[model samples]
Target: MDTTFPRLLLQHASQRSSAPAMREKEYGIWQTLAWGELRSLVERIACGLHLAGLGRGEHMVVIGANRPRLYATMLAAQALGAIPIPLYQDAVAAECVLPIVNADVRFAFAEDQEQVDKLLEIRPQCPQLSAIYFDDARGLRNYDETGLHALDALIERGADFAKANPAWFEAEVGKARPDDVAAMFYTSGTTGQAKGVVHTHRSLLDRAKAGADFDALTGDEEVLAYLPPAWIGQNIFSYAQWLACGYVVNCPESAATVTIDLKEIGPTYYFAPPRVFEGLLTNVMIRMEDASAPKRKLFHAFMEVARRVGPALRDGKPTGMLDRIKYALGDWLVYGPLRNNLGLSRVRVAYTAGEAIGPDLFTFYRAIGVNLKQLYGSTETAVFVCMQPDHQVRPDTVGVPCNGVEIRVAGNGEVLVRSAGLLKEYYKNPEATAEVKTADGWYHTGDAGFLDAQGHLKIIDRAKDVGQLADGSLFAPKYIENKLKFFPHIKEAVAVGDRREKVCVMLNIDFEAVGNWAEKRNLPYAGYTDLAQKPEVYQLIRECVEKVNADLAADEKLAGSQIHRFLILHKELDADDGELTRTNKVRRGFIADKYGVLVDALYAGRTEQFIETVVKFEDGRSGRVSATLKIDDARTFAPMKAAA
Candidate 1:
């Protein structure tokens, strides 16, 4: 079988010409595109690129939300042996400049005027960028056309070129090899500048196929392509796996409409980072709080039953007949309606990756029969190194190694992987590539984890972020932080105690959750900073911290890592503020460095710390927010007594 994406796409087109290949929600209507239509569109675009002098070995950048045309543009570029580098569409011009300049991008496809403007703004920094094409022409009618062209125009040009040179398009596609670099993805660069990871067709296809087979995914399964295509995880799930398994992909109308579109589509296979799931659960809990007393009572009653037997039943574990009957009744009364509301009723297989999910949150989904599981991988591994099989899912462990993937722990406890999906190299950055990929074909995952007795991989934290207490007790900030974030009010947290006596944390409260809580109590405040400093808010968060400490105390190994001192951050952590990556993963080092004073206050026993932080707004404006943040101490629990 052909491994290159172009050939695989052609094969699907011939085999399932009339079947739905992709769908896009446009103007309140779902528009379907058939496999045959996709093939013709890709061919025209590929031909157009060829006519426009886009040659083999050249690089093209795709910047936009998930759209059918944007995806096709990637395949078109690949058909001509050109590499497509998808950048996060919401990224500022400055953030986008580095990869564009480093990759020496020659052609770029933008979604609309906003993306086109960003590319134009950064064009001087990327001299190699010759042509900029846009999909939506709205707001672009009066723009400079020096090198700007509409994607539709490009397709028309390609059609004309194909008539003139009929064999040229297929000839270019025929030249693709399994070993050829299929795509280039830039890392999120949580710690430093982003590096482009290059993967061959063989690497991506092999991993995608393995995952598809493991999940028993079929061509009929549907998925929502809402994540940033720039992220390798999204590419692996929405592109590589979609093509490999011939599944249908749906694009939400907009970011704001994802929830509605999700319900309308009811995707069979879904993937989200922990934060997404957290947000969904938070919303559910918030709504439940406002529900009528009778409804709320019914919900709690059924939830109790689900919590007891839902996971057992989900894993096919033996359960009492009475409990099974109770669970079935509860599923009808609570779980079924709840799943339908969250648009997860059809989810046969779902996954969460990118960061550690809170164990309670992980179990809650399973208990509700969502089939939620965890997987662990990075961009360097083409996004599949380990995956939890159904009935083998655990909240703590990510899963066993994927098919044909070998995982081992280094002496220092860093997880290393050797897999068919391992990236070939970091494009134009051999030094960076060499640092992670060894001569023996092992790719250093830079994650600290160990295999459990059951052979499941348990990720503690990033190798660099895992620290030790002053007395040499293990201090995993993410572990504690995840525990804190489990509380709906605590949206983001940073635990700091490396080489210190005890753990301290700085957290940002969920504005929506806390604000609503405050309003219900007649506690009026101005904004996030104002509301955060409120006495009632602090008390509320203190309870959350104390609860986390109690949970930590129950575990002998992590009892000493409980939070000792904490403070509510003056502002919410934002990607625009450089505290989070585009995908919402914390920039730990950056946050620590940026808020060093706050960290010092937590450790120094200061009652309050005055701080003024410079922040960036969505409109590219900069401003300062100053506040006196109060430090609070939480009551830690003593270790639980052993069984007697």
Candidate 2:
């Protein structure tokens, strides 16, 4: 019953020696590595790291995509009693400097030449960083630099060291304890600077085991590890759970090839944020537009039937014979092919977190036979606070509290949790840690939610993000934004109305979806900027806003929060532009400050606003984009009176 990650890895390797433990897509084919092989590889890496001056209790940074080698490196660090800090691969060098410097990372591993170059460039700023290793040696053949070594060479060194000192590796692994910190993860910092959240072996393993048991997962289950390992949710699913349940973990070749790789693997368990699902649905809708008239008709007809009975069939609810037959036909004609195309045909249990998913989007997956549910958690809680049970799933709720977890709402409406999976501390920041974690051990979740009559948790929004209107009405921006994002045409929305007279929003259109819609009408446009500025596009978005307003009018609590003014953003919100965090959470304060002029124009009732924004490219180049965005007003509905 050892719960430490290294102990679990050793146990699984001995019990399932020849079973497939990990797979990586390489050169267009899957390369499998067995459990025994994984054990030997991790042992060599641990020995090599020790031989190369990595000491117990020291820190090592892993910056890479979801690669088998990167995952092993994490375990290898743990095997030697060293801690691994995984960073987002997409973060720029400047964005990476803080964590590298703060963690005092001396040894580092990068995915390829691009990541190695970034580490090398930032090395001067991080004098503590002594060694930089890379897995892919494609472009490092010519460069000669100190403290730069290939991972293959390190593993070779490790193998030689292991032969010379066999007992050293085992002794180090034996030294690991349940209370020892297993890993360090940096928060996404949507509100402020990222803080390192540290968790112990016992805390993380307990949550992972609870989650696996809740879903009845087995060693035969398969999962795709494509999300950033730096995030707590990804590490919980891909690392802790993989070792806890002895499941096979598959790593996609690259970010660009995830969709194709997912199809090839056909994973049984899946987890994605709401945005990924939205993008998948958007692509499907765009393609359906170009299909033949008969094909389009067939899709729509089956979809209507699916909407009627898909959820009922999925939940094993009773239905009439005629409805059941219609659903069967729809499943054969639409649901089956659609699930296959989206690579979710084999998804036995899927969950989405990090934000509130649109109800329409959530229902679509369940209606199409994808068993997609929602969970609610944060980095400080080890990513499992609330999870939906299969038969008890509901679109508006994130289900009951997870096993071994306790949840209660504070007087201010912020959710509070006390669980074995709670974080140990915010590394080196006692002041920040004290603000959230109380003396009584309840971790303040900072999310506003309430338990329903059925003991299900329903998240309203971030407690800090909820505001009040000038007329003293409740205003929740995320509630309104989720409504806007439910529309296929609107990819991103930011609502603003704290202490303002009425709610207004900034919009970003889905380039592919709206572009396809425009082309069908023979409306020519040059690019995103041109299409976004087109008068027809404004009219289209106006209709969407009006529809949301009508829906809001029907609800007494949020009727006053309806959108009154809106403008299409001059450009899409980009992580590089500081509009979004690395994990894709909007930086509300940063966006508001950067676009203050636009917000001013919206409230002032100006017809148009001129803005010039500086943007950064992938290659670190900077440029400016200027536009004259027109402001549009939508018709608002009067609130309905409740029966007395």
Candidate 3:
């Protein structure tokens, strides 16, 4: 058995010398990298870092979107026994800069000039940062510095060094150990400031190999590397899995062109957050509405059949010959083209993580034979905990504990996990480490959930967020919010009242769907902010909310979470307003502070009100907008009848 991941990489490279190891979209073309070439590239990069006045135990930070070079650099850092810290690219300068400074990163690999500029702006403040390297040199044509180096130039220099002193670099690579720090990732601090989660080579390698083993990966598997590299989910999928499986890792030409790149690559293995899947589903549904009448009818007809049989197929049940024929027709006429259009034609295995996936959303893909499975983990675990195995998958639960992972539910229902993949500690934050990891050894997941009869983990909500109604009924805000969002009309929702009178909600309507409906009715609106406040759109959303209420009332465990009242805010809840985090996650405390008056009005039985709020344009300009707010009465349904 291999003890170190680097050894496995070398072993695989030697075994599969000519196999395609990586595929990246460059200059509108798909580029293939063989195993030998990839291994060589990593080795050379590692050598370059060794030569750049860096040695064992140093720390390096990588910032930006996903790219092949980013993964190479991470491995290169590990190979040199240095720690690489990947920061979320979507994070604002202030949100991410502190971690880089705190980690004392001396050499940094920046994705582009924008990231380079951010580092430069803070260089004076960070005395430890000695050099900044940029992979993409698009806009930094004139920027000159004693410490800045372009990626290509570094690679060339590394090549020349390797030719001159081959044995010297080998000695450095030999210095790496299983317990050496490999990387440090900062968690998206939705509740507090981001803390660096530290991982060692053993922790990461164990999770990577377990993931590869679970998925039964082969070198032929192709994956699209597009999510933010700072996220552990993407890091595990793109870098760890790529290195473990020796598969072809494909990068999108750029973030903007991911869709085009996906269509071109048509990867065999795919992973996305529930939000990405939701966007794809919404895009298909929207296009269907605009398609020809025959096309629309045919699409719906086949979907109806798929809706019936997809679950059966996903559950591995026996469908009769007639249903099988219908499924075949649906796949050929409806599902095939639909999957192709969504760039999922060749997908063999798919995973969704970072949040809970709605059952309907999970079923829809599985019904179409997508093989999508849900997994459970966090940055602390190197992103491996419980994963639903193929053919035994369930949407409501994240499946059995992964290999080498031990999971147990604490008395209060918080999920506790212990595994080789657990992070070493939070960098410079011993207090946080002590708070999360108990003296007994279990790492508290903070999520409230339990294992089902089948030994699968079913998450309810955050342990801190799970509250009770005045009537002593359970109210899971996240579950209710997810149900509301399932409707195409509502984009996002915030369920209020932790211990107040009744549950009320603030909704952000889907602009595209609402805008299209408004256009059909000849209702003119300026933009998203304008469209959100439209009275006509308000009535439409009211109906959707009522339907959600009816559905919630039917569920005994969640009836108390039904929205008692709701309001369409004068403006959409935006990240720029401090109402949402950079990753689009709602900052509940921040939002409540910013919109205290508005939330108060919803519960106070106000029919309507006018408010002025500041809005930030995408260009970083600030402006004010005023609009009329509309409120709707709480929806109430008749009490459920007792079973006879």
Candidate 4:
């Protein structure tokens, strides 16, 4: 009858005692822990926290990269019936204050001295915050000892406590209920303050079970835990799924070193946002371009064979014996190594969520034999609403609702869902919660979508952002932006002019692709800001726009979204600048306000303009950058062909 997360650890430990639980790279070495060892670590940490006066319902914050200790602390909190709140290690001192205050976190297990200092800096402001425990003791020689405690020292103290009072830990865990709160996640608000989403143990477990039912993951599969633990996606993938399906979670050494760690793990289960996948594809293409001539020729030849047979196989089309044999040879000779190089050789069930994945990026992985599928969910829904099932996967749809989940579209095309995994409420924000949750208990997803005959959900865009042009045709920016992102030269795109003369857009060039083009032409640049403003870069973007226009013209469902005008911004949008969220979602309102002058220049009927913008550096310094802006008429394409 244990309701805490520690039971997940003990459950797997007993069932798969010898199975590898976590592997982290440190100082050019890979460190591993079997399931039994991982469970023991959690028990010791739990006993340590208990001896330090932490008890049931207390809050403990974990701040660090993906590591065994960080994960151990999470389970330790659950072992004592305490809630574990995860904070993004990269968040600045000011950004950390709100969540710390909201959770009323007094005890914290920080990865390094830097994070411990961040908490200490705001200790005066946060009345509930007191004790700070650090895993790495580097640079802490001068820190005060009143509240600072080294993890090693605490573990020594806990060993004595476990010998004296072993039953107390079990008693506290027994008090926890399935509906009792397990964690509080803070999601950045588009309008103002961050709201804490409270999730219960039942919510997490049900969500994980739904996900397992959706994809039918096996126990032998492995997952790479590289994304920020502050994200719900990471919580579900790294913790909940491990509990539900007994899959192993691989921890990367650090964010910068994920690629190398991924190669070593060769995980069977993978999940990433569209940007991450796009970057991976871009990097692979760049490396191939620099490969020897013979390797390049052989790679392309096999890819050609893959291009022909892979799609047919994916679609279950009939093929002759010779074509099947040729495909097998191509896979063994070319696609096999390509997958190995990208750390996807063992990928069985991969998923892309958080944003629409370009069809090209989607197909590339499938062409190489990875079952890359799309999923649809939000933080409020516990990240398990719909997922494309194996072999029934479609590029446009985000598969059927998961087990025990129900979804329906309102008359206005807004999606509504009801599931056991739904959040109880926005913590202390009943008014806001009441708005999103209906009296009948359906959670308004705020996304506009339709269900196909196959019962798959086809999301068009946000419900509010689905506007109409003067001709009354739908203008879905995300739909068009996904089309633009499919092009190699285009990286990020924003479509504007919803109710105006025509659909205009802004494009961010793929820096690596455009920078390489500049280098080959002997065009030198100081940085991204300078390179992006080059006149030749405008010509390059123009070609990309033309290509996207041609692709759109062929698709009748999206012909009205063709670009009519566009201008490249001098500076890239950064999350720290408030233009993007911590989750990497564009803050459309903030961007529109910050770049209002640039937007004006694009539609002012002028070919050229100048803009001066205030920029903020990571070190809390501010400056200004003024550059001449170039505006080009967005490429126009032929109208949709008459209905057959």
TM-score per model over all chains: 0.98, 0.99, 0.96, 0.95
lDDT of 4: 0.82
Clashes by residue pair, model 1 = none
Error of model 2, residue 66, in angstroms: 0.8
Please report, in order, the local distance difference test score of every candidate based on alpha carbons. 0.92, 0.92, 0.82, 0.82
Instruction: Quote the lDDT for 114 in model 3.
Output: 81
Instruction: Tell me each candidate's RMSD, in Å, in order.
Output: 1.2, 1.0, 2.0, 2.1
Give stretches of model 1 more than 4 Å off: 641-644
- Total colliding residue pairs, candidate 2: 0
Runs in model 3 deviating more than 4 A are: 1-5, 570-572, 615-621, 641-644
lDDT of 1 at 18: 94
Misplaced by over 4 Å in model 2 are: none
Models ranked on TM-score: 2, 1, 3, 4
Compared with the true structure, what per-residue lDDT tens digits does model 3 show for residues 469-521?
87777878888888778777787888887777688888888888777778768
TM-score of 3: 0.96
* Prediction-by-prediction clash tally: 0, 0, 1, 0
